[model samples]
Target: MSAPLRVLGIESSCDETGIALVECAPAGEPQGVPRLLAHALHSQIEMHQAYGGVVPELASRDHIRRVVPLLRETLAASGLGLEAIDVVAYTRGPGLAGALLVGAGMGCALGLALDRPVLGVHHLEGHLLSPFLSADPPEFPFVALLVSGGHTQLMRVDGVGRYELLGETIDDAAGEAFDKTAKMLGLGYPGGPALSRLAEQGDPAAHALPRPLMKTDNLDFSFAGLKTAVWTRMQRLEAEHGQPIAADGMARPRADLAASTQAAIVDVLLNKSLSALRRTGLKRLVVAGGVGANRRLREQLDEACRRRGVRVHYPELHLCTDNGAMIALAGAMRLQSGQAVAERHYAFDVRPRWDLSAL
Candidate 1:
C-alpha cells in the first residue's frame, strides 16, 4: 500500500491564524474522507474588538506573531515533525490582502524548507466542503448554503471542484447584516454572536422587519436596506425614550429589535434555501460558514428539512468559522480527485476578491 499523504494547512485570510494537519490516501488508492490529525487556531477577535472591526495592517502583524507558534503547537499535538508532511496548503483568496499574503508567504516558505509541494486553496471552497468533516457527512450532488461575514451563496455540489453557483447576495451577506444591525443596536464589535444572544431574550415577533427579496422568484439576496431599517428603528426608539437605547444594559426595546432583526434574516435564509432545494430537486442540503452556527437558522432549517424529507448537514460548530483543517482537507480532496495538483514553484500571489465560481 502507498504511504498516506500528510498535509499541513495554514489559514490567515482574516482575523484568525489557524494551523492543522490532515492525513489521507494518495490518488488511485482506496478513496476515503481525509482525517484531521491535529489543529490550533488563534482568533484576533479580542485585538480587533476595540477598533470596532479588523484593521488589515494590525491583523497582518498579529498573524506573523501567531502563525509560527500555532504551527509548532499543532505539530507537537500531532507528534509529527516537519518532514512528515507531504503537502502544504493555505487559504489563497477573497480576504484581506495583507492577511492573505502572510499565510501564503508562510506556506511557501514551509514548502521550500520541507521540499514539499504547496497548494493554494480557495477560502469559500474550504467553507463549502467543510461539512465533510462532520460526523454526519453528506454525499455528493447536494445543495450548499455558504454564509459568512463577506459572502452569502448557494451552490449545487457534484463533488470536489465541481460546484454550480445557484444564488448569492446582491449586497450585504447574512453575517454582514447581523453585524451591521448589531452595530445600529449599539452592540459591541463582533456583533453577530452578541445579537443572537440578545435575541434569545426578546420576542421575535415584537417588531416587524422587512424580509428583503423573500417574495421574489429569484434567489438573490439584499440586506443593505435591512441595515437602514434597523437604524431607522433605533432612532425612533431613542426618540421615544428621550435617550439612546443602551445595548450593554440589555434593555427590552433593544432586545426586541435584535430578535426582530434575527427573525427577518433567518426567515429569508430558510425560505431561499428551501426554494433552492426545490429548484434543484436535491434531497440533501449542507450549510457551512460562520452564520451556519446561528441557532435560530439551524432550528428552522432542521424543522423545514424534516417536513420536506430532506437531509441537512453542518460542520461542527468550532469548525464553522475559518480554520486550517478545512483548507488542508480541501487540498487533500482536490489532489485525490485529480482536480488539482501541488506546485513546486515558490512564487505566490493572492486574490483579495476572487470569485468562487471562477475556480
Candidate 2:
C-alpha cells in the first residue's frame, strides 16, 4: 500500500469552529474510508444565546479566536506535528461570509507556511459524506438526505464530488422549522435540542398539526406552513387560557405542542427520504446533517427502512453536526477518486452561497 496522505481540516462555517486530521490512500489504490486521526470542535452556543440566534459578526470573531487553539488540540491528539500534514483543507462556502473567511484564510495560510497544497471543501458536501467516518461506513450510489440548518435536500450520490440534486426545500429547511418552532415555545438559543428534549414528554397526536406537502408526489418539501400552523395553535391556546402559553411550567401544553411539532417535521423528512429511495431504486439511505441527530427522526427512519429491507446509515451522532473531520475526509476522497486536486496558489476567497451541484 502507498503511504497515506495526511490532511489538516478546518471548519468555521457557522457557530462552530472545528479542526481535525484525516488520512487516506493516494490515487491508484483502493479508496476505503478515510481515517479520522483526531478532531476538536468549539461551539459558540453560549455566546450566541443572548441573541436567540447567531450573530455573524460575533460568530466570525469567535472563529478567529478558536481556530488556532482547536488546530493545536487536534494535532496534539493525533500525536502529529504541523510538518506531518500533506495538505490543508477548509470549509469554503454556503455559510456566513465572515465565518467562512476565517477557516479559508487559516487553511490557505497554513498551506503557504507548510509549502503543501490546499483544498476548499463544500460545507454541505462535507455533511453529505460524513457517514463514512462512522464505524459502519456506507458504500457508493446511495440516496443521501442532506438535512441541516439552512438546507433540506435529497441528493443522488453516485460517488465523491458526484452529486445530483433530486429535491430540496422550497421554504424554510427542517432545522429552521425545528428552531423556529422551539423559539415560539420560548426555548432559548440552541432551540432544536431543547425542544427535542421537551418533545419526549408529550403525545405527538394531541394537537392534530398539519404536515405540509406530505402528500405531494414530488420529493420537494415545504415547512413554512407547518411553522404557521404551530403558531396558530399556540395563539388559540393562549386565548383559551387568558394568558400567553409559555415553554416553562406548562408541561402538558408545551410538551404536547413540542412533540406534535417534532412529529410533523420528522414525518415530512422521513417520507421525502423514502420517496427519494423508491424513485431511485436504491436500497441504501444515508442520513446526515444536524437534524439527522433528532431521536424521533432516527427512530422512525430506522423502523420504516427496516420494514422495507433497506439499509440505513448515519454519521456517528457527534459527527452529525458541522465539523472539520468531514471536510478533511472529503478532500482525501476527492483526491482518491481523481475528482479534485489540491492547489498551491494560496490566494483565498470564500463563497457564501456555493451550491453542491456546482461541484
Candidate 3:
C-alpha cells in the first residue's frame, strides 16, 4: 500500500480566509472522497459589513492577518505539524486580484519552505466539487449547479477536470441579485442570508416578481431583470404606503417583498436546474456555492427532484460558501484521478477572471 497524501489548502478568494488539511489515499488506491482532517475559516463579514459590502483592500489586508493564525489553528485541531503535509494548494482565480494573490503567495511560500509540491486550484471548480465533502458524496456523470457571489453556471460533470458548460448567467448572478435586492430593501450587509431569513416570515405570493429566463428554452440564467422588478415593486410599495417599505417598525411589508424576491430567484434556479437534468438525461444533481445554502432553494429543489425521481446533493451548510477544504479536496481528487499534478515550481500567478468552461 502506498502512503497517504496530506494536502494543505488555503483560500482567500474574496472576503473569507480559510485553511484546511485533507488526507487522501495514494493514486489508484481504490480512492473514495478525501477525508478532512481539520479546517478553519475567518469571515470578513463584520469588517465589510460596516462598509455595506466587501472592500477589496480591506479583504486583502484581513487575509494577511488571518491566514497564518488560521493555519496554526487547523494544524493544532488536526494534531499534525507542517511536516505532515505532502502537498499545498490554493485558490488561483476569479476573485479580487489582491485577495487571490494573498492565498497564492502564501501557498507557494509554504511549499518552498516545506519543500513540498504545490497546486493551484480553480475557485469555481472547488465550489463545483464541494459536495464531495458531504456525508452523501455524489458520483460522477451528474449535472452541477454552481451558484455563488458573482457566478451562476450549469455544467455537466463527468469526473474531476471533465466539466462541460451547459448554461451560465448573462448578467447579474443569483447571489449578486440577492445581495443587490437586499441592499435596495435596506437589508444589512451579507444580504442573501438576511433576505432569505426575512422571506420565511411572509407569503411568497404577496407581491408579483419576474422570474428571468425561467420560461426560456435554454439553460441560461438572467437575474438582472429580477433586480429591476424588485426595485420597481419596492417603489410602488413605498408610494402606496407614503413611506419607505423598510422603515423602522414596518417588518411585515419588508418580509413580504423579501419572500416574493426570493421566490422569483428560486423559481428560476429550480426550473433551470431541472431542465438541465432533463436535457442531459441525468438522474443525479449537485448544487454548490453560497446561494446553495438558501433554505427556500433547497426545500423547493428537494421537493421538485423527489417528484421527478432525481437525486439532489449539496455540501454541508458551512461548506456552501468559499472555504479551503473544497480547494484541498479538489486538489486531492485531481491527483487521485490523474487530472492534475502538484508541481515543484515556486513561481505563481493569479487569474482575476477565469472561465470554468475553459479549464
Compared with the true structure, what per-residue lDDT tens digits does model 3 show for residues 58-142? 9999999999999999999999999999999999998999999999999999999999999999999999999999999999899
Identify the runs in model 2 with alpha carbons over 4 angstroms from their true place.
Answer: 247-249
Off by over 4 Å in 3: none
TM-score of 1: 0.99
lDDT of 1 at 70: 96
C-alpha lDDT of all candidate models, in order: 0.93, 0.92, 0.94
Score residue 261 of candidate 3 by CA lDDT: 91
User: What would you estimate as the lDDT of candidate 1?
Assistant: 0.93
Residue 336, model 1, lDDT: 93
Kindly report which residue pairs in candidate 1 clash with one another: none
Better of 1 and 2 by lDDT: 1
The positional error of residue 323 in candidate 3, measured at the CA in angstroms, is 0.7
Residues 255-277, candidate 1: write the lDDT tens digits: 99999999999999999999999
